[model samples]
Target chain A: MKAPGYIFAEALRNLIKKRATVLYPYREVEKIHLPDGFRGKIEFDRPKCIGCQMCFRVCPAKAIEIIEDERGKRPIFLIYRCIYCGQCAEVCPTKAITLGKVFENVALRKEELEVR
Target chain B: MSFEIPIGPQHPIHVEPLMLKLKVEGELIVDVDIDVSYIHRGIEKALELRSYPQGLFLAERICGICNCAHSLCYCLNIEQLLGKEAPPRAKYLRVIVEELSRVHSHLLWLGHYFHTLGFETLFMYFWRDRERVMDMLELMTGNRVTTSYNVIGGVRRDITPEIDSKLRRMIEHLRERMKYYEAAIRSEPSLLGRLQGVGLLKPEDAIRLGTVGPHLRASGVKHDVRLDDPYSGHEEIPFNVITYDTCDCYGRVMVRIGEVFESLDMIAYALDHLPSGEYRLKMPPFFKAPVGESLSRVEAPRGELIHYSISDGGTNPFRYRVRTPTLANLASVAAMLKSRGDYEVYIADVPAILGGIDPCICCTARVIITDEGKKTRRITTLTELERYARERGVRM
Candidate 1:
């Protein structure tokens, strides 16, 4: 019911427009600004942590584990298992654990994912 | 003589794993059997073992594309059990994100549908615009694909002014693009020829076979959960319900595209009238829900997604059930594919018919493990399924 030229013209118009594809890995891109409440990797502060195990109990993924050291008990985060829902960070009384904006946690070794 | 052509337990046409056994005489399909037992993660049973907060993650992961709907439905279900209502501001925010996800989901489906039909340019264009929606989701909820935004009480994050401005800009850009798309679809003779009068489903049959969402609407049945059962600030926001009476593949495509415009309008309204208050309530992490059961339904991108849960005064659910939209539409697919009387279906129309429902096979096929060697079927619980995988040293 319609002319064929119009369809081709419509398809060709996008060519003149700016490309929407992002140049990743090959080129340096613009910095991504995460919002204030962005839930990312769990960052635990050893000094502020009271070893109360609140983060451990509230964690959905069970990614946090508290271990006893000479000073006191400290938590280690298994990054791979963490769903990054920010429950641990929210439950932390002293704000020892927080969801940092560093979402690119890719590593070659499995041990690299474990953070203190 | 008729021949059986098995399309898939795996196929490139559909992104998800679905087995379609088609019985054909020449090029015409005579009969069809859809096997959706391949992808079962035991999510419902797994939900029964985890606590309420933990279960939210599992629920969201059920369907990657419609995670927002799953989490929202789960939150609404739990909130009903707790007898707690989210604040006004939170309700508006929920609507904003829910509609944004709907935009992204519909765009994704539209692109994929065209790609299946060999129109790669439109596919590329749709996906490119979809990225803008994904960026908005990442900006608002922190994650792109699976935005774990909805919590038990309300949304996880609040909307900031900066994000609001960006959202308005993106919506405006998409409006222009969608208009062009609408025009293109209307004029393209080849596209119309491929789609029109293919895979017909009558209105009575759609209701009889339990079709939901756009699939039902495509057949001239006016039904939508947002209209029927208003939830998450849907009552305040007004939008038109789109339906096409052609009852064919073209109608399905037209209905979805029309709904995208409707979603855009709703998102703009929600953003303009954004309320001020706490986005989430301070609920205890571990608390036993009172003995009761609640059913919650959300209009997912695919269709109506229902979540039912029973709590026996325990931290974990006693039983959890999920009825995905694709399961409801599968019977209708069988009816359409079968060659009866004047309706003749060819094997070439398989992609159009399957994609018409916008099938999410992963969500639909979450049960029934058959062992052909033993000639028996064993329904394994999540724990037992885990052990079975472990014994075989299989990484799922």
Candidate 2:
């Protein structure tokens, strides 16, 4: 019911219109616009944190670790295994931790990923 | 050995290992039995051991392709369970991301299906085109693939003006390109000849087997979770539920292809009317739930993904169950496989059927061992020869 020879001509019409991709990072440092729920790095309030291990225990890959001292409670994220699910920020008992829009850090080595 | 032929668990066709024992009389398959549950990591079981917010992240990893959908569904379920509702702006943003994901995921499946059929040019064309959708997703969510956007009350960040403008431009470019795909479909006689009248699953057969998503819609079923039970501002976004009455493999593929354009229309609608307000509502960490059960369903790219959660007045969930569409739709494959004769024909049909529901092997199959089952000598994905050695060790 259809002709086979016209495949190339049809595909050519599609290719000629040009893709709409803009080089994002290079687009001069205007205000960096983002959508809702963008997974940025983890942020902690420090004051509201209740020292419970809700966030550290719940992280699937053990990305978040609870480090304690005289300062009450502190949690460090190993960014290498952080799948960016934001579980640590969400499960924070005291509403002390939240994810912010700042996912710029990149490290080649595993040790550079430790938040502590 | 007995007259048994095991087809998968490690085969060229299957995306994951799921062995099927075929008792054959010469070339004719007399008896067939499936061996699923081979790829199980108990993702639902993993979720139960965590709190509500902790469970959200684990849910997204259930399938990499529909990660956004998983997070959205989980977030909505938790929102319902918490006696809270997402604001209109947050709800609209959820619709945009979900529709964008549907476009990206369907095109991904198209590339893999064409690759399975040995059509290299078409495979490249589909994958190349799919990158545009990925760019749109990247603009919305920082990451290209694992975009865990939804939180308890609303989304995490906000869609800025620049991203919205870019999305609008991309939508305009794609609207015209969709016409070319339609033209290609009209012109390719070979593809039509192969696809039409093949792998016919009648209207009744599709419903009886609990088939969902485009597969059910292909058989002329007017049911869509979005239409039947609207969630996350899908009630406000204006889009039609695309369906066809043909009930063949060709119908299924065509319906999905056309739906990509429909999703593009949805993205435009969402961006134009993008609302304002605080992006997210905060939820308490250790609040006790009302000790009840709730179910939420979303029509994922594959099918309806239903999450059933039971909570008590505790930090962790009492029970969690996930009913993936692929697992439910796989019940229909045994019937579809019987019609095709010869090994090659059946093997080719395997990808089409498995792909029809956009099968995610990681979500569908689960391996459990009540006993060793005699330790039958077999091979694995590791045994398959590869030019590039896998980089396996992970430590910190």
Candidate 3:
């Protein structure tokens, strides 16, 4: 039973089968599969945020910054610094912050990545 | 002449920045010295600066492949410090995620191992299957790699019925694929030729040299953190500890493959017998831990991962130490690489030997300054390192 190239059959069989990987960028966006509750880009709601500084304190990466304005206090998220652990969303009392499925959050500039 | 050949710091064979100084007579390796001081990020010092909740995220980044284990161990350590334990349901949920991650890690290792051994076909096959487990992780924990699922006191998320069914389906698919892979591995002559009778380490040597996880299990030693300590409600879950007596690279491969099956079963069992209660406990985010020290151990896919922390009744830990399994297993690698009388190690066999332990060099990297002139070696703390740099007329 100790034959050489024993895995060749499975390898050949795989050639006939559908390709496992999705052509994410090259093909249609629908080809890529993102599961439900996939932690990706951070989405912040200004009005819903209570400005308890809860997200700032609990953020391990210090990705969230509190800015005081006429609308009381709101958090500006530095998305590049975010680890995407969804801790801010989990700790948000008003359900203001949520991790959206838009995983392709790359940007040319640092400012573009920030969510206020 | 026995020539000294340097393998890495950056080499094709090493996956990470690991330098192996090999003394070789022709192709036979006479002696070896391993250097893993390349990528020390000073995570322990960083943990000391962060609060318990924040430290959990930092801990998860310690090892990407074993992030679940790292976060779980950190959570367990902090929970112990806070004099609290996760509820029954949370514990079971933790076990499910832990085992799932274990399966994923083992599969990744198996694929990477074959790739190192120059078996690309099996490598592709293994990784193709690993995507299933990754998808399941995403489904259950909201993220794929850095799940960050385990927080202090309890887990971050609860499993839904849909996820539970998907998990069971993944388990079934993996089991079938694993069975085929196991048979293929056993029957394939080329893989067996590379693995068998290579990287030989006796059971006694495995223990004396402090090898852990599947590497130790492959040496016919029954030392598992899950089996021995039973943290995170592992005591309730019934699973067999797989061991192989070959004490070679073959045994190591077999032990990991066996562990994948065991992990699948454990996940299945955990899901079936999951208790119904509060998954997460209500706790203030920015609270101080009591003045005490707590140590936690988890059976990470690589080996036994140890996390120790000391609290000075502050928002952050006074001191934090992490003993990654790769660090413990590196000693055994040095032992295995040397050429014995009948047991010879060749330059060709280096990859087989090194990959057997599933070396995660970044996880194992720690800074130790050895003053050669003074003949003294000491581990420098972050403060001491800064002070030493200043004293040496080096600007920060």
Candidate 4:
């Protein structure tokens, strides 16, 4: 049973099978599998945030910055600095921060990536 | 004439930054020297600046492939410092995720190993199957590679009934694929030619060189951190330690494949016997650890991973040290690369030998000064290194 080219048969059969990867950028966006609760880009809800500074304190990457505005204190998330570990979302008392499924975080400017 | 050839600071044989100074005579390798000083991220020092909760993320970043093991070891070390243990349910959940990551890591290594050995078909097949495990990881944990699943008190999230069923299905599929690949690898003569008797390390030599993980197990020595010092509820799970007596590259491949099967079985068993209770203990985010030193050992996919920390009753550790498995196995690599008597090593066999240890150079990067004139090498402290550079008139 120590025959050479043993895997060739399997490879031949695989020629008919559909490709494993999807054309994500061009088409087949729906074909790309993203599981529920998948950690990706950061989304901040300013209304729900109590400005407890818990997210700022617990964030491993120091991605959250608290700023004072007309609505008391609110956090501005530097999405570029976030590791997407979801620590901020877990520690948020008011459930203000959540990791959305939008993993395509490319942006030209630093200001564009900030989630205030 | 014996010529000195450099494999890397950058080379195609391995991906990570590593330099192997090989002295070759004709086709035979006579002497070898390894330098892994590149890509040192200073993570140990960074851990000291961050608090316990923040340091967990830093620890998980030590190695992308074995992030689960690193984070688990860090949590165990900090939990010991706090003198608190995770609940029963959390421990079983930890085991499930830990084993799943282990399976994924082994599969990645096997596929990458074959890819390096010029077996592209096997490589594609292996990685194609690996996607299933990655999907399972993403389903169970939030992310895929850097799971960050383990926290100081326990796991980040509880396993849902849907996830449990999905995990079982993945395990079943992986088990079948692994069996077929194992049989294929054994019967394929070309693959066997490159693997069998390629990198020979005797049991005594393996132990003497301080090798750990599958590389050590492949030498016919039965030493596993899980069996010897069970952590994260590994004591409750029953599984056999797989070892092969071939004492070569073939054994290394076989040992990893066997481990994948064992990990699947362990996951199945853990899911069946998972205890029901509160998955996570309620603990504050930032807390001071007591003044004590704690050490933790985890059997990472590659080998033994050690994390040691000293807390000075502060929010951050006073000092932290990580001993990655790749660093320990580097000594054995030097031993295997040198040609001696009837056990000849050629230049072509370098990749086969180096890939056998599953080298992660980024995790093992450290500095050492070697004197060419004196033919001596010594590790220097940071202050000493700075002073040496200053005295030599190099701009600081």
Candidate 5:
């Protein structure tokens, strides 16, 4: 017959084994990186944007607005309310609203953050 | 036939209004049903309607207690869409505010819990302690609960030397209080008597039901969202993850009681190693989100708050969804309630139970009332009781 002592030892091993609550992400956070198709911060191609107001109409939070220019269309943006959900870039026929890898930092004043 | 009593639709117990329909057989609760959803902001639906930058601000408004968490996660989702990151200095500021908010929230819950326990003296003491933490928050973010102090690139405000000193002092006072709690738990047999093994949720049940925050940690599980998903330079910050083995109400208190100290150590770490830089970066309100989807999780005062957003390459999100921690913890409450077969004994020390899981009722999506027939009771408020006491010629 198999040894009863071995069964007890196995039970002890399983109890501790089932209780491993340690998150291993700490050891590998450095190795992790976003895949190629990942999207993030919004970037604008000023030349391609036609000031059509399509992006503004498509904006859910009304964060997008048009600027007044003597010669052509204006592009304006407010940073304070932006959630960066990435809807503007996809709807742009000219691909003016592209997602860039630029991360903005905090500002002292609200007006300083508005980009046009 | 015994009647049922509905105690909500407008009640003082929860941060949000939750209606509780209790079937009672002569003051004994026979059956209970819960109904929520009075304040459903439809954040997910709203997310589908706004631009990326606008979504961040609105997301923060979802819960006043953890506005920073919702804002942080929303920013991360945008960053994921834009494929960018926040600078190191901004990251440190985020961590500082995050820990500060944790302290403020826990202090508030602690005070409320004491009020429920009929220990008004303890409640006053805890709230007095909370004022110190709130001072730190106001100094840093200009507002206490609605701290709209973060942006996509980094944090909106910076901490100066004076503010940092105030923070250190607050943490110092809190350390003394935390030590007292430890002593109280050790000596006050009544505390342990009421808490120990009162709501025993086996370890397996905790994990299976997806409990988060102190509720899960109380079960001897050391899972913290900051540790699991290190955002805002959390990977670099050094702090201990506290856990308990009791898996009962006492276990929950013990875990939270230990967290007060942990927050202090983290504040010290963040302050000493404070990164030097510009506080906020520039991101426009009319920014475009790339065509993508992302999910971000933050360790809020309650537990892990998860936000998921899908963008269709426009200024607005196609969908925005949030999974609050309390929602997850609610799943396990029935398990504990049924274990004792008595809500009166289990919930008699109301404040202690209320503080167990940090609740922000404002964000709950659904509240259901389960009862066979309609019944009603005119519950008297404390305000009314005091009036009665004075009129009856009773002297205190």
Candidate 6:
């Protein structure tokens, strides 16, 4: 059991410690050092692609679509539906798709989210 | 005559969409009716349409806070169906994240519960500390809230040394804060006045109503899925099941607080004793499961979350059922809220009672909007829904 003034003493101690609240936008926050193996937006290495369809098959979100354009059969990534689970990256036989560190893929248009 | 005091399909006390019809005679609550049909996403049906891997994602989304539990249960269910287990190291990793999530959840609840009881200072303090847990989660799983870390075979990624060190530091920080909180909660007269002996739930009543998790534990029932039915190497890890025999709202708070400490210890143990092996099994991307049925139960932060899946040699499950803890605990709410001759319950105690069980109505409820005036009841099929969506084009 604690006394009534326990909170005040704790608050007084916390006053000296660094504030937990981050002043974002108004102040330039220190850059966050992302750990390795972080799952972010998918980066497709088109040159390494053999069109194995492994990524297309394993994608749980159905975010990856194999588009047969004039440039040959290539997977078109719909970031709008992408969950960033990175199953596509894991299942990619040719190591084509990699989950990059850049997670901020927000945009005005959903079309802008799509990555070929 | 008893008047109805309807507390929302939308209310300030809780964030989720749930309606409570409290029959009151003056300030005393006479009866209670809960409507949990406001926010059903038909996620179970959607899970049936998707493959095993796809279902994992949907399962994780069942409850944002208990995503790890849902995903773990889903994986265990599928693994049982396929007749394989995740590697030992992976099991430890699962325990690590799952327990971390539990800490995050318990802290989140503690903060939210105090807030509901009008303790804004404690709320701010709890939430401020909660950010550290969230940071640990983000560091470990990559995403803070919806951690898509737990995959079917194993986890999505492995933990690095930096993450391990950071997590330990955070756990130490949290341990100190929890100790302070425990002391503060025990001695705080105002908090005790609001919580103690308010919204009493007897042991028999709790068991009868099938109340699982901390709520049941609060009523002095020594039952936890982790202890009773150990999943994902829980048996290998040593931890105590914390329970309080107060049989009231105060007991629930104590139970959760005790759990935070236990979860912290469990995470540390799992990290220290983590085995070195393949995290995930090599399974084909899309494969049909042999005809079988498997049920997996996880001790989620709230309570026992059970997932049952039946597969008939199909890519997708034949039937999938999710029994969230909140749904089970809701039955006891009505019993607790009723004002008996001696055991009285007031309107102001509504939040205290409701918040005690840590209600996650979104996980329990499903919405089916009916057009009564038109007199048309339509059950839209997946194909029809898909066609409608396609015709509308994709809107952001």
Candidate achieving the largest DockQ: 4
Candidate 1 residue spans exceeding 4 A from truth: A30-37, B366-373, B376-396
How would the docking of model 6 be graded?
A: medium
Q: Which ten residues in a row have the lowest lDDT in candidate 5 chain B?
A: B342-351
Q: Report the TM-score of candidate 6, chain A only.
A: 0.86
After the best TM-score superposition of candidate 4, give how far the Cα of residue A9 lies from its true spot, in angstroms.
1.5
| Index of the highest-TM-score prediction | 4
**3 versus 4: better DockQ goes to:** 4
Mark the 10 consecutive residues where model 2 chain A has the least summed lDDT.
A28-37
List TM-score per model, in order. Answer: 0.94, 0.81, 0.95, 0.95, 0.69, 0.92
The list of candidate 6 runs beyond 4 A from truth reads A1-3, B366-396
Q: Label model 5 with its docking quality class.
A: incorrect
Error of 1 at B385 (Å): 18
Residue B330 lDDT in model 6?
Answer: 94
Q: By DockQ, highest first, what's the ranking?
A: 4, 3, 1, 6, 2, 5
How would you encode candidate 3's per-residue C-alpha lDDT over B1-396 as one tens digit per residue?
Answer: 999999999998888999899999999999998889889798888888888888888999998999999999999999999899999999999999999899999999999999999999989999999999999999888888989899888887888899999999999999999999999999998888999999999999999999999999999999899989999888899999999999999999999999999999999999899999899899897898889999999999999999999889999999999999999999999999998899999999999999999999998776689889999977667799889898999743
Q: What's the residue-level lDDT of B51 in candidate 1? A: 95
Task: Give the per-residue Cα lDDT of candidate 2 at A38.
Answer: 65
lDDT tens digits, residues A76-98, model 4?
A: 99999999999899989889999
Per-model root-mean-square deviation over C-alphas? 4.4, 8.1, 3.3, 3.2, 17.6, 5.3
How do these models rank on TM-score, best leading? 4, 3, 1, 6, 2, 5
Task: Categorize the docking of model 2.
Answer: acceptable
Rank list by lDDT: 4, 3, 1, 6, 2, 5
Stretches of candidate 3 off by over 4 Å are B370-396
Q: Which candidate do you rate higher for TM-score, 1 or 4?
A: 4
lDDT of 5 by residue, B1-396 (tens): 667777677756655676666666555545566555667667777777666665666788888878878888888778877888887888888888888888888878777765655556556667777877776776676555667677777776667777777788878888987786566455555456667666667789899999999889999888999898898788898878889998878888778778878888888898899878776666665777788889888898889898887777887887777888988886676555442343343234333444476667777665233344665434354566668779996631
